[model samples]
Target: MEEDTDFRIRFSSLCFITDHVGFHGTIKSSPSDFVVIEIDEQGQLVNKASDEPIYKVNKMLPEPNNLAKKTKLDRQNLSFEERSNQELSTLAGCSDGDQIHAPGSEKEDTIKDGTSEGEEGNIDVLGSLLDEKTDELLSQFACDVKERWDSKTELIGPSPEFSLGRILDKNQRTILHSAIRQKFPFLVTIGKNSEIVVKPNLEYKELCHLVSEEEAFEFFKYLDAKKENSKFTFKPDVNKDHRKAIHHFINKKFGNLVETKSFPEPNYSADNPSVVITVRFREKAHKHRKRSLLECQERKVIYTAFTLRKENLEMFEAVGFLAIKLGVIPSDFSYAGLKDKKAITYQTMVVRKVTPERLKNIEKEIEKKRMNVFNIRSVDDSLRLGQLKGNHFDIVIRNLKNQINDSANLRERILEAVENVKNKGFVNYYGPQRFGMGRKVHTDQIGLALLKSEMVKAVKLFLTPEDLDDPVNRAKKYFLQTEDAKGTLSLMPEFKVRERALLESLHRFGMTEEGCIQAWFSFPHSMRIFYVHAYSSKIWNEAVSYRLVTYGSEVVEGDLVCLDEDIDDEHLPSSKVHLVTEEEESANTYAIRQVVLPVLGYNIQYPKNKVGKWYQEVLNRDGLQTCRFKIPTLKLNIPGCYRKILKHPCNLSYQLIEDHDIDVMKEGSYIDEATLSLLISFDLDASCYATVCLREIMKHDF
Candidate 1:
């Protein structure tokens, strides 16, 4: 192993998300399950790893048979709702349509479900009763109307009348299949043999009905409470059949629990009922925190993780909150909670209306404290603290009062503290602001206010894209136009209307050059094709591709040729070390990745910008038509990696493309922002070590 000259070439730089946005399963593409590749200085290939060549390795499960449908599998079972199909004369299946939940606006937008707005409580009486023949009841059902904004599309919008899916990621597919094994639950099936399959034609909102908090809570609360008391303590108050159905749903959704029983007193009631109720069940039976994390996003989402550095302390929440405070996060933003001010912590956070840079700038402008911004990453609307399902933390503690607390005592205390925090939930302590040395306001009060504010921001993500960590990644993904890659599937007709619109909204707040665009996300790329008014026009109709189109003037593609055009002289294509090989050459041929994105006649290219002036030149040469951009950069000599000895000379001229393969996304969906953060793979590792060695991560004892 040591014999290999280049480690980067020899070993893989594995990025484990430990968290990310939900799978775009229905799109028939997932970032996970693909392969990996590494590039060199001139954008040459340094290494490659193809995880899976044949996409959709697991085909969709086959349709169930009458005799086969009768018996459910062991790890899976049908909900009582499906069992009622027995009374139906015919199995009224679903139709072909997109699965869309009506979207709600920020101020007073309401979800367009059969359930009532504001009064989600009355859903029990307002929504139609579950029936085997969904075609019948859905025909009569209408979603509740409420005040809403015309801002943008939404997630929980009115459920699509019809939609079908091919088995994509086996993980999510299995979740859906296990939820309802019998009758086709939304046509999603997991065979008794564990294959994920879908029916061609489908019926109405049965899947939505399964996760609907209203019906789920009603049955499970009763079952959970009864199980807690004694045996067979069945009650007839809440329809017996309904009780069984709820029990079954809970088992599937929350995993299996101890002998199920109905709650003696329902969380919902006749008087004033709460729209949201936190039910208590045996902890052992609990599951779905990860699956349901995204569901709770409508409630509020926040993330907090950190990276340590000596000369600088990275406070992720502070940066995120400051961005929102400055009004960038128009929708809203928040942290799961705050961290100790002295510690260097890097974490992902969400807000309804903040830009990534505004978040990064908070750290940038604060050089007065001998601290500088190390680096920060972004997440989608679905990214939150607990929502991450897991966390990757890098911290440093300093100025320890060794005499005040011994290592043994401190260790004991930290472990106990962690256990207590997890069990009872943190103190909800107000962040540094509570005491930011301001007359000592009660921490709880300030913390409560932050919580409320964060929730407001979280609920607002519903109006926009589910996630956006790598702005550069977004442009590259969209621009690369490699439809073959699963990540680019968003370009498909089904997603264009919504996903594209969201990208445009983001572009309005960021910058782009050619097919390569950069946001505060900070993606690392050796070279980028340049374009003016790239998203709107077709200037590079033959040269380079446009990353964004709605706001762009063109989609252009071209070679990242040498900077032949000296600012001193107007001639381009100079002593440029032409990347195109003799066999693959045509003075840099541009391919139209997506006809939707224009390939403009843009020709500005650079391995990396030496100064902001280069960007200004693109703008000057192209005028205002040239978009503005911001990117974080780290200049480190990466150890060269190896590639299998095959193929022609390494073509380092690799243009950025959307990671469309499932293998690339398996760890988690890599959004533009997420990808950009990866660019900072090497930066001040020495400083990071210094902080940790000094014990600077500890907080000021309250």
Candidate 2:
């Protein structure tokens, strides 16, 4: 009898309770009308003369047929803060007494004698009982971010541009799901009180279609449900938090690509005795670990790790300058890959026969250059590009407000995001690092200009500083823009060595446009190659985006599939992409494990289908042809290469740490008191980026 009575009470409440009851006018509610109250961040309720928590009486509407009716009043009086414009629009065309069907309710035809057939309607369902204001805030925030990134991409970058919606969807699927499931995608130990338990309402999806405007509405409610149930308190709208986390992840990871060169495996004669053979993957079932002895002498290679703190220089530039200071040429120095200057990057570098004393002095000199060498050791071989197995990154992301203080629910939500990423990894489009992070001018743009023989434009864009905030660089850029090449040479700063060299060449050749072209070629071979590579990388990124959106992970006929995982090595400066044959294409027995796309070059043979058509279309849209990649003027006959359609970071790990843990004081950086941060660490194979891993985590497009 008691259970029956409880059910009756619940059923009665459900019939009358609507999540967003429209108010007739601007009248505010007294504290007596609300059963419970919570304060907003501004600590204001009703602004006229309010000190107490003024509540809005959820003005209940009378039920008409299945739909609720708003009180007779002009909606024109409604303020932005109190308006539900979308909801109001749904109630249009219905007269005062006409029958109306509520959202998720069965049509009159579908319902017979007050009983619906098939699944029951979701009217007044538990999942629908979310705070409308919070839902609106979250959704609006998400939409704004998506629109912003999309607009920015349309202006300066390649087409098939970055999609903020797709990124958010990916993040929601990967990171968020993992966190909620309490399962890390890659294995790791959990921190204290990291998990939050909650029951999800599975019936919500059937009730109504999630609209584009309400992209984040359901997520906000999902978090709100826990708060209402007193399971744990978390902010209903985490838009700010989401943005910070996304941008932070982007700045740290997805901002760069690691380009390397391919070389043959080391060969040694059997007579040599100093070399030892090591098994890469040993079986645990074996009685004893097996090993093979190889004959070779250890090369004098000094492996050193350095942290770059400034953003003004690229990795190769810093290493080259360091070599010059050490009285040796840059050719004497070798490194696995270049690290990003925009970050506090720690990476390995190798130099032969450099004494410990000299290396220590070099380290001290680097400190003056806003860099620090933290580790140095002797290795048996020279560290060629892509020699290292992978890079392990420990990144500290700051200024996230959503998860600040005791926001356990926010943390739980983040964990959920992380969980989503763990199950199915993200699409690995090359980050902004593959192309330079210039606002008006990108490296790929300059490269494309070079390919099209737009030397004057390329030279101008190159001299135009990416960071306009720097007055010195900005002034120098202005001089280059307003003055002739001859005059600009005198105005160029001493540090603007590349720009000065180009200007000098122009002046030397009578300030003619041909001199500008020759001047561009005079830069370091490493730097010149980078521009062409950037163009190729951009094509690869765009192709990957198109492939994932159209065909997804499934393989189709005429698709150029990669036969081996090692196909990524073909991306090396010296190699090219090799697609499977028609016989292989005919055999559909193999799983669609890897799809590789080609970077444009004369040697590139595009897939003979929609994929190939897309490649031609993209090139055509850029007003160029694949043959242009073999330009004689630039001497850049960059061969086509392959990039894996998807990348999953290996050994991924992350933890949300306190701001106090970061040493911002050393750099005189001031962190917001309300900010929360994350310390994410992960490892990626050579040429695979840590930023890509972060993209999987945060899902922010730009």
Candidate 3:
């Protein structure tokens, strides 16, 4: 009843009541006629009328079938009732003009005789019933996010391509049903009441058909694109959040040809073997006593406990939501951020620490096999959201260019870059997710509009429900629109009127006070913090200084270069893409480096001829001890003295080796010239045995 308070009649009808006097002599009627037209909640017709209900007068239409010529006085009004929809489904028929039956009643045509029958009627009835049920279900629906999947091979970095798949949620199922149902095939989630809810009136099949591969991208909303100066690189859309997908995708294409390398078990001998659990599962007899909360203390025994994967966060949230639906209060639980579905992830969840019977009952609801326990143990308390800090990313890169120019140099550069980032810092730019790619611009625009609307509401409206064209609404809308362009146009009225006025006002009175006012208002986090922060400064400064011209990648032809030299607007394909030359393709690369050995100062012997401080020190301290003790010289002619070589995927090696007399060492070794000649001389204190691969490129065209 309380819920129905908000429900009002949507359709109107008239109830006719006739009052006739049976006169034998003369037929006479009242001179004036009176009628009453119904009013809505506020006693107004569509809220346009005055507060008072209006009365009307008009001649009444006589009932056609009544030969007595009886005039009808009708009251127009909206009718409604509070009743369960269950009765509507049970209904087998509706009044067909006061039970007027077809001439085929005797033929037992119940449908024609105002009774629901036959396949057509049954189909209609079923459809209606389904419609009602669907509506009832949707009314109670909250929020639902879909888990996407891939069906074909996907290539990820460091691995060969492999196959992809997915698992969907119920709302996705609903969308699928709706799409496959009737006239329209798409089910769009519309924004309202600060939430995105699915549109109503879609049939089950209609919704179902909407579960499509291409259509799914429509769900991503748009956002405003930053200016050209900003480093807004696009991030590829990761379908389904499947972590192992890229590896699988890569493996598929080159799996048969590429030989598999043996992955031996780790050689670390654990010092703390006690941390390992000997028994993973326990039998019923060894389990603890348990009871369910729903039953009387003595009546209910704990059923059993089961483990869930702790890996996926969504699985945890799903299980939690499912448990709430099943009236089961999880006694114990633990999880990290929602893990990707379809991936074999591990998580921990516990039912009440009750007996086997009660646990069994709840465990029946735990449906997913992937969710069961890997190992069960007593954790101090249930693990909540974001308990884990980060993940260990393991990767493998394969199928690189065989003949890479300066492979050693390139490898060093990449390794150095990685080390540089790890040591110094990375650009604190936003990840490439702010822009919605793959999704059509319309979706992104809508999202941007929504964001702008919210910003306007927060900044301008604050709280109000006035006309959108009102000064307050207009002011809020002003903030929502983009603030670029040299001058406002005078063509259009709706938007131009405001723009032109604002432009004139700006010209006459200088910039709007709100710009400064808004800045001041946005200060705490937006002004003071952002202004003072190095990250913001870096972001803006880098934006101002974006450059990418390498030493020799220049063009001699007429080049329509942009103001920013590296970013030429007229360049073929545009600078947004990382364009590499055909030669560079044979040697595509990025780099990183790690210094395992810390530098401790230099160990310098008298260069045999130095006039520096060391020489001066020796001269002063030892009183010119010019005795040639041979400097304890080490002829140290070590033949075949090659340092240990460690192989890396990119095929480059580095090591510590003895600094030497280049001429003597070059002539001293007895190894083959080919391998021996490759050993370049290093004039450093530390030595290195570098294993280099002369990367060779081969392209096959059959």
Number of the top lDDT candidate = 2
Candidate 1: Cα lDDT at 694:
14
Give the residue spans of candidate 3 off by over 4 A: 1-334, 340-372, 376-384, 401-410, 428-702
Q: How close is each model in CA RMSD to the real structure?
A: 28.5, 39.1, 41.7
Ranking by lDDT: 2, 1, 3
* Model 1 agreement with the true structure over 1-702: per-residue lDDT tens digits: 011121011001111111111110111022121111212113322122223211122221222122122222221221112211222112112122221111211112112212221223323322222234542343232121101111223326443332223434434333332222122222322122323333322222332343453442233223322234323333334354445454543333332233244454546576533232223333332233675644444333232122222122223333433432343321233433233344333333343332334445556544444333332433333333222211222221211122243434333343343333223221111122222322212222222222222222211221222225454335334543432222433443331322332233233222232111112112111101111111111122111111221112221232233323221111222243233333333432422211121112233332221222333343354333333222112111212111110011111111112333212222344344222111001111100121111111122222
After superposition, candidate 2 runs with Cα above 4 Å error: 1-313, 327-334, 350-361, 373-384, 401-409, 465-471, 482-490, 571-592, 626-628, 660-675
2 or 3, which is superior by lDDT? Answer: 2
lDDT by residue (111-215, candidate 3, tens digit) is 211122233443454355345665444333311112111222332353211111121333433232222112111223322222223432122112123333232
Decreasing TM-score order of the candidates:
2, 3, 1
lDDT of 2 by residue, 1-702 (tens): 011121011111111101111111110022111111111223321112322312222112221221122211111111111112222222111111221211222122111111211112222221143246633443354354345543653323421111112222322222322232121111111111222112211112211122222432333232212222122112222243333332222211111111111122245334331222111111122233444422111211233332233333566667656655655434456665666555544444555445434666766767767655533444334445554455555565544434223343445455665555555555555556666543456778777777777787777667766555564465456656664665676555655545655665554444446656556644644566678777777777666666665665566666666656664444433233345555665665344446667777766677766778898887787778545576565555676666666566555676655556654232334445345566555555556655555545553322
Better of 1 and 2 by TM-score: 2
lDDT of each: 0.26, 0.44, 0.23
In order, how many clashes per candidate? 115, 22, 81
